[model samples]
Target: MTQPIVEMKGISKSFVGNKVLNNVDFEVLPGEVHALLGENGAGKSTLMKILTGIHSRDEGEIYVKGEAVEFNNPKESEKAGIAVIHQELNIIPYLTVMENMFLGRELKYGKTGVTNTKKMKQLTKEYLQQLGIDLDPLALAGNLSVGQQQMVEIAKAISVNAEMIVMDEPTAALTDREIERLFEVVDRLREQEVGIVYISHRMEEIYRICDRVSILRDGEYIGTRDTKTVEYEEIIQMLVGRELGTLYPERDAEIGEVKMKVEGLTSDAFHDINFDLREGEILGVAGLMGAGRSEIMQSLFGYRAIESGSISIEGKPVNIKKPTDAIDAGIGFVTEDRKEQGLVLSMSVKENLSLPNLKGVSHQTVLSEKSEKELVDDLVKRLNVKMAGQNQEVRMLSGGNQQKVVIGKWLGINPKILILDEPTRGVDVGAKKEIYHIMNELTKQGVSIVMISSELPEVLGMSDRILVIHEGRIGAELKREDATQEKIMYAATGGE
Candidate 1:
């Protein structure tokens, strides 16, 4: 048997008085992919943080290659051959790809204290070649698409010669082809005898890539088992402590007449778009990356300048030139990029929950703290958001909880039309169910929803109608009864 590459024995940690982690044990072998499975707030992240030195364990013993070790900080962990790629890509937007990759550890000019630009470029090219990824090293990081940015992050991690990598939801924003490329990279790393600790909520991905699976429940160690020995359902039960029946609630949509219509919509990014969203119905937009699904939502939400368009709410023409206008017109947009556009990380959960509808929590045109607190508390309970309290900073919450906060913000406004762009992206299964419940409740109240999703199963399972977009135009419209994965993919690919 191969020697263990890393191990954490009896790890215990906490914040203030709360025991976030209690006697957790984790181990990973060289050249193997070890999957960390858990629900939101199950202490997966806290345990990993201890390994990477983001947080020191209150009590624990760490053994690296059968030798005792402790990381004092992230740099120390990196020096010990551990690296991390966060769910949120961490590339500097304005910097070039090569510059971002060689940020702190640049090539020096032979005993001189000056960096060598030519050597850095050459090394970057070699690294990309080694990974079988073709990218322009001089291109600005932000100018690349999300898929390309993710590849750059992987290359950066590998450039440091890391022997162990912690990947946190690496494929959350990627397409099928991008995911395949990532798997190829992982295979190469495994051949190099590098250990990878993979963290994700997608069970299919875990079984597809990992050799062993370790589960955690409520901050305690459950068990580590061979991937082939356990069924997926059993793993999910261990995570959430219950069996999930139907992912989507009952679809009792009334199918009312169109409440909002867009005709001849043209923007610099897209053109000649037309669609109608009906009251008491969920309409899904299906398309590949860069097929203009998100662009349409942004244009409709008044986040982008529209060259020409006609929008009518309730058969009455209205001008939506800004986000405030869109909100006032009963349109609430939940953007795909939650961290960048949805929530203000520095504020409390209560502040973020009340953001879209401060007026509702105000008295005599002045803010009422008591009413705001009450409203936020109610939303927290309704959404099943896991947090210490409403006063906790939004940044401190997990990815799933932050997503709930975004949905709560829009629901607080009580909009008649809701546009959800990848609403369940990067969320855990439990949070996804809660979001589906929220949608069910809203549709029952006559609110319209337009869901934009890359996950075909989610679209078919949840939407009342599906609109497939290709090259900035609608290719086909399928009723929920007639929708299928192949049909939607055919339409999304322009029937090619």
Candidate 2:
């Protein structure tokens, strides 16, 4: 057998008395795409961080090409031929693609202390071309689409002469065509014998690209197997450490009378949209990226201006030109980018939970700590938010817990209509189930929900009715009984 390219033995890491990784073993071989599978908070990220020198392990032995090495920083790890492409891309949006490629390690001109721009651009262009990327080297990072930017990131890795690449959810924001292109790049890298560590929650990608699968459950290594020989259910069971039973819970909410109605809704991004959301119903908005699904929701939530529309709640017309108006009208919106748009990261969990209904927690022109605490405590307990304490910073929580906090904060508003934009976007399966249960509970309490999701399974499984938006128009409205993945895709792509 050929020697492994990268190996970790007896790895363990702890944070503030919490053991995140415990004696976990992971390795990758040259020319192999090794998948690091785990649920959120299952220590996948922590383990990867340790390997990339972003975090120091409390106990472990790391080897590169059969030689022991201890890297004290990310630069050292990169120098040792390991590069990480994080889920949330780390790129300077204002910088040009070529500039970003050689940001830290620029070529100098013969002791003149001047950067060799021509050399950097030439190298970046060659690297991008090698990866089958056609993006212009001089283009600003922000001007490129998500897919193009990801390609630039990969090209940057290659320019650094990285032998091993760790890609975290590389396809999360990519379109079908873009994903295909990425896979092409991955195949080329594999052909060149570069070891790749692929981490993602999407099972289909694992089956499509990975050679070997390794499961981590609650910070413990379960086992590894050849991807081709492993059953899909077996992988799920291993990562979760139990039978999932079902990906989505059974719907039990009884649809009631129409609680909110929209007529001839038009915006810059969408046009002439009409829909009715019933009490105790989950109305799912489905579409491809940039199909205006989020734009419609944002307009309805008063985050964007509606060109023409009539919104009625309980048979009464309402004007919502701002978020405050929407909130006053009993509407709650959980934005798609939770970290940037939904929660205040610097604030404590309790403080964020109390933000939606500050007046309710205040007393006569002054804030009341007792009232605030009581409200936050109720929300935290009700939502099953995992936090050290109410005073803990929200940014400290995991992606799943942070999402729960975002939802819990909106629940504090006691809204009659709730709008969730990609509520389970980056969360794990366990977290996704918890969020679904929460949605179910909300509908049970007579709250109507407008859920916008890119994941078809999520929309089909949870929604009582699905609205497919295509090219800024309502292409199809599918009843719960009629919607399927194929049908949804057909409609979402502008099928008649």
Candidate 3:
């Protein structure tokens, strides 16, 4: 057998007396794809950070290709042929793609110290082409879509000649087509004998791409198994340390009267949209990426302008020109991008939860801490949000907990109509089940829901009615009893 490219033994980490990882052992062979699976806060990130030199280990030993190494910083780790593509991308938005790719390692001419722009752009183009990414080298990073930005990050890693690459939720923001491209890149990298450490909550991806799987639970190593030899159920049991019976709970909410009506709704990204949401039913909006599903939700929630449309709530015509108007009309929106638009990362959990309904907990321009605390406490407990405290910064929470906080903040308003766009985008399977249960509970209370999801299974599993969007228009609508993956895809692709 070939020697392992990277090895870690007896690794442990802690923060302020809270142990995050304990006596973990991990290794990856050259050309091998190793999956690191765990629930949120299960020490996956802490362990990876120790390997990448972002955090110092409490006690551990690391070896790179039979040589002991100690890295004092990320730069040192990078120089040692280690690169990490973080879950949250690290590209500078305002810079050009080439500029961001060569950030901190610019090509320069001899003595003069002038940047060799031509050489950098040429190398950037070559790397992008090799990865099957079609992007302009001079385009602004912010102007590119999320998936494109992810590709750029991968290209940056390859440019560094990294022998071992760590990918943290690399496909969380990717589309189906983009995911295919990424798999192709992975195959090519494997042929080059590069090692990959893939960290994700997605089981399907792990099974499809990884050769071996390592399980972690509550800061301890459970076990490792060859991917082909292990059953899916066995891996799940090992990770969560229990049997998870069903991925999604059964839908039992009764459909009531129509609570929201849209006729001839048109926006820059979508046209001639029509849908009716009942009081206790989930109306799912399904589409391919850029099919205008999210745009429709944004327009309905008054975050975007509707060029032509008529909206009615409970038989009353309403003009919603802004988010405030939508809130006043008993509507709430949980946006698609939680980090950028849904929550303030720097703010406390209590602050974010009360941001939407400050007026209800304030009087004469004087805020009531008592009322705020009561409201936040009730919603947090109701959503089962795990947090250090109400005063803890929201950014410190895991992806699942952060999503719960976003949902809890919207629930504080007690709106009659709720729109959720990719509500479970970055959460784990357990958290997804919980969110679905919360939706079920909301419907039981007669709160109408409009869910936009790229995952077909999620739409088909939870929705009462499914609407397929194609090229900025509603292509088809199918009742839950009639909907199937084939029919939805056919319609979403503009099939006859």
Candidate 4:
């Protein structure tokens, strides 16, 4: 029998006397991609943290290659040939790719301490090429897109000579093209016999890549099964402890009159965009990576400079020069990069939610604490946000809950038009259903929506109409009944 690359038996953990994991058993073998499946707050992160020495396990036995071991810190795990590529990119935007690859461990001449930039850059170039990436080693990390930054992280892991790499929601920020590139990298790592602990909310990827699947539900060990043998519903039942039925909840809202109109909208990234969002309707925008879907929406919301455009709300023209202007125009935006644009991680939920609706929560120049509390309280309850309390730091909550905070904060203003960009990215399956339900409810109240998503299923399942953007232009307009995955792909790829 092949020795397990990493193993944990009878694993358990607690935080401030609250149990998070209970006797969970997990293991991975060489050249295997083992998926750790769970919903948000299901203890997947907790278990991985304990394995990497970020947290202490109350009970457990860990083994590396059948040798008993204990890692005191992440550095110790790295020394033991283990590395983690976190969901959050660790690249410093100002640093060059080569500099980021060798951060904190710069190569230097022996005894002289002179930095060896040439050798590091060469190594970085070679590593990036090994993964079939065309990124320039000298390029600034800050100038790269989210997907490029992610590929940089993988090159960093490979440079560490990692035998086992943990990937947490690796594709959450990626486009379909970038995801394909990532999968190719994964395949190469598997060829090198690298053990991969794949963590993600996406099921399709598991079917495509993972060899084995383990389930964790509310901190308890559910079971493990061969990925090929296990059915999708069975895995969902294990992770969520319930039959999810249909991932997309059936929509029951009616589409109505035009709520907002955009004509001849042009920006540096996107051009000649025109669309009409009807009240109580969802207008989904689908496109290839870098097709300028986000730029179009940002331009509409006054987050980006528009070269030429005409926007109207309820048939009345409005000049939106900035985010505040758009807000005043009754337009709310839940940006794609929520952590960077939507919410302040350091701030409490109450403070973050209150930032967007100060006008509604205040009286003249004097802030009204009463009104702010009412707004925050109502949103929390309405969103069913799980947290220690309203005052808890937003970063302390799970990814799903953090997303709700982003969406809920916008609701305080009672906007007529809402824009959700990659709304369910990095969120778990259960939370996704909740968000869909919320979207349905919002449309029921006559709040128009414009959803930009890479997930074809989500676009098809929720949108009343689909607009396929090809190279920054609307290539095709598809009705809900007419839109199919193949048709969207055809239009997105510039197939006229």
Candidate 5:
């Protein structure tokens, strides 16, 4: 049996009187991939942060290889052979791959301490080769795709010769091929006796790569079990404390007449895409990574430069050259990548809730504080955003709650046509259900919805019609009843 690489017991942490982690216990064995399963606010991130010294625990004890230690900072944790690759890539995009790998620890050759770029590149190449990863070390980090940048982070973690590595949803944005490559890398790391803590919402991945599983719910340890022995349903039951039954909500109602139409939509990022969204309908766009689903939405919303496109609202052709134009056309967009584009993390919940409704809050060129508060207060209650009050910073809220703010902000605009890109991405199961109900509510109100999602279940469950995009073109459109996994996957992968 492999030895335990790291262990924590009685781990409890609180921030500003809120108990984020409550007496959690976690463990990882050498050469094993231990999956940490939980909802977004289940204290998974907080527990990992405490382990890595991002935050000190309010009460707990940590043991590395049977030796007690307290990590005061990330650098110290790295020295102790532990590293973390977050969901958001931490690489400096402008720097070369080799430079990023050796950042803050560059090799010096002479008394003058001259940086040796060649040595760094050679070392990086060797590390990449170790994992059977082929790439140009001299290539700029920014030029690489999201998946490639993720590989760079893995290379950097390996370069440190760390004993344990924690990956937070590493394959969230990766393609099928990229995910296979990631699994291969994990196998290689395991061969090197490096324990791994894999955090992800995708159950299929846990069954594929994880050796053992640890579940946490509401900041407390639930249990750990052998992946080979436990079934997926059992694991989910342990994590969520409830049976999911059907993973997706039941669909009702039929798609109606085309309420919004796009023809000859062309942008530098994407080209020649056309689709129609119907009244009381949900049309889903499915694609692989970088297949331009988000790009199409951005072009439609007038956030990007559309070289050519004819957009029609309610069957009337109109011009939307900017966001203001889209707004005037009664279009609301909930962007993908919620952290970067969807919500203002620095602002309060009330401010973010009223973001898209600034015009409503402005009375004769002056901001109406009372109206803003009233609007947000009602939205908060309606959306069930769990916060102290409307004045709390959005960043302080959980991922699930923050998503509600984004939806509420757009709903307040009362858009006739809503474009939601990856609406439930990275949200917990409960929150996902909330978003689904909200979509149903909007459709019941005769508002048209265009949902772009990579998750096939979500696409099929929520969409009245599915439009699969491949190679910057609409490959096929299928009715919800006809949208099977095999059919959609075939279209998405450009298969006949």
Candidate 6:
């Protein structure tokens, strides 16, 4: 057997009195893609931070190619041929691809302050070519798609002669095509004997690209198994430390008359979109990236102007020209970009939760502290948001907890109809199941839902019916019993 490229034994870490990683062991082979997976607060990131020198391990032995080493900072890690590609990319948007790639270690004329721009550009091209990326070296990073910017980041890592690369949620924001491109690059890296630590919650991708998976729960290492010999259910069990009965709950809520109706919902982003949301129904919206699924929902929520449209709530026509009007019409919207659109990261949990229910917390025109506390407390308990306190900033919570707060904010409104866009995009499987249970509970209470999700399995599992959008129009509407990934993809691509 080949010596592992990197190894960590008896790793332990703590923050203030809370232990995060407890005697965890991890290893990566020269040409293997090892998956590091767990729930939101499962200590995956903490271990990686220790590995990359961003944080010091309280107790551990780290070896690079079987030689013991200690990294005091990220620069030291990179010098030792280790690099990290964070979910939030390190790309400087204003800089060109070449400039970004050669940022700190620019090629210079011998002993001179002047940068060798020509040599830097040439090297950038060569590195990008090695990854099979054909992007221009002179293009502005801001002008490039997220996938392209990610490629630039990878090229920069390769430029450092990195033997090990850590990719955290690399495909969270990419389209299907972009994901395919990233997988191709991973294959190339594997061929070149580069060790990759792939971290993501998407089980499909883990099975497809990763050779082995390691699990952690509540800061303890569960175990590692070869992907070829592991069942996905087993992985979920390791993640949650229990049997996750089913990914989706039963849809027992009975369907009733239409709660909201859209006719000729036309806008620059979409056209002639018509749909009827029956009471207690989960109407799933599915489409590829840039297919206007989010745009249509945004327009219905009055975030965008419609050229011509008519909306009827409970069979009564309403003029919703703005968000306030939509809210008044009994509409609650949970946006796709939860951090940017659905929540104020700087505010406290109570403050964010009370933003939409201001009227409820206020009697006539005056605010009532008692009402606010009651509302916030009830919602937090219901959503099971793990936080230090209600006063803690929303940004301090984990990804799954933050998403719960977003949904909770809307739930406080008690609207007749709820619209969720990419509701569980970055959430873990445990949190996702919680959300599904919550949705089923809401539907059981006769609340209608419009769910826009890119996860096809989610659509098939939860929806009473699925709508496939193609070129900004509803291409096919299929009952849940009749829908399949193949059929949806075909309709999403304009097939009849």
> What clash count goes with each model?
0, 0, 0, 0, 0, 0
- Tell me the tens digit of each residue's lDDT in model 2 across 280-308: 99999998888999899888888999989
By lDDT rank, best first, the candidates go 6, 4, 2, 3, 1, 5
Error of 3 at 119 (Å): 3.2
Please give, for residues 1-496, the per-residue lDDT of candidate 1 as tens digits: 7778899999999899899899999998999999998878899999999999899989989988888888889998888888999987889999999999999898898999898999989888888888898888899998987778887887887888888999998888887778888999999889989999999888778989999999998899988888988887778777787898777899986879899999999886678898888999999999888888889888888888889979999999989889999999999999998999999999999899998888889987999999998888888888888898888999999888999899989888889999999999878787888899999889989999999998888999999999998888888899999999999999988894
**Candidate 1 C-alpha error for residue 213, in Å:** 2.3
Cα deviation at 351, candidate 3, in Å, is 1.3
How good is model 2 by TM-score?
0.97
User: In candidate 2, which residue ranges exceed 4 Å CA deviation?
Assistant: none
Candidate 4 per-residue lDDT over residues 333-450, each given as its tens digit: 9999888988999999999999988888889978899998999989999999999998999999998999999999889999899999999988988899999999999999999999
Q: State the displacement of the C-alpha of residue 42, model 6, in Å, after optimal TM-score superposition.
A: 0.5
lDDT of 3: 0.90
By TM-score, the better pick of 3 and 6 is 6
Tell me the spans in candidate 4 whose CA falls farther than 4 Å from its real position: 108-110, 115-122, 134-139
Error of 5 at 57 (Å): 2.7
Q: Which candidate tops lDDT?
A: 6
Which window of ten consecutive residues has the lowest lDDT sum in model 1?
A: 232-241
Which ten residues in a row are the worst by lDDT in model 5? 246-255
- Displacement of residue 98 (Cα, Å) in model 6 is 0.8
Computed on alpha carbons, the lDDT of every model, listed in order, comes to 0.89, 0.91, 0.90, 0.92, 0.88, 0.93
**Reference-based TM-score of each model:** 0.93, 0.97, 0.95, 0.95, 0.95, 0.98
* Minimal lDDT window, size 10, model 3: 240-249
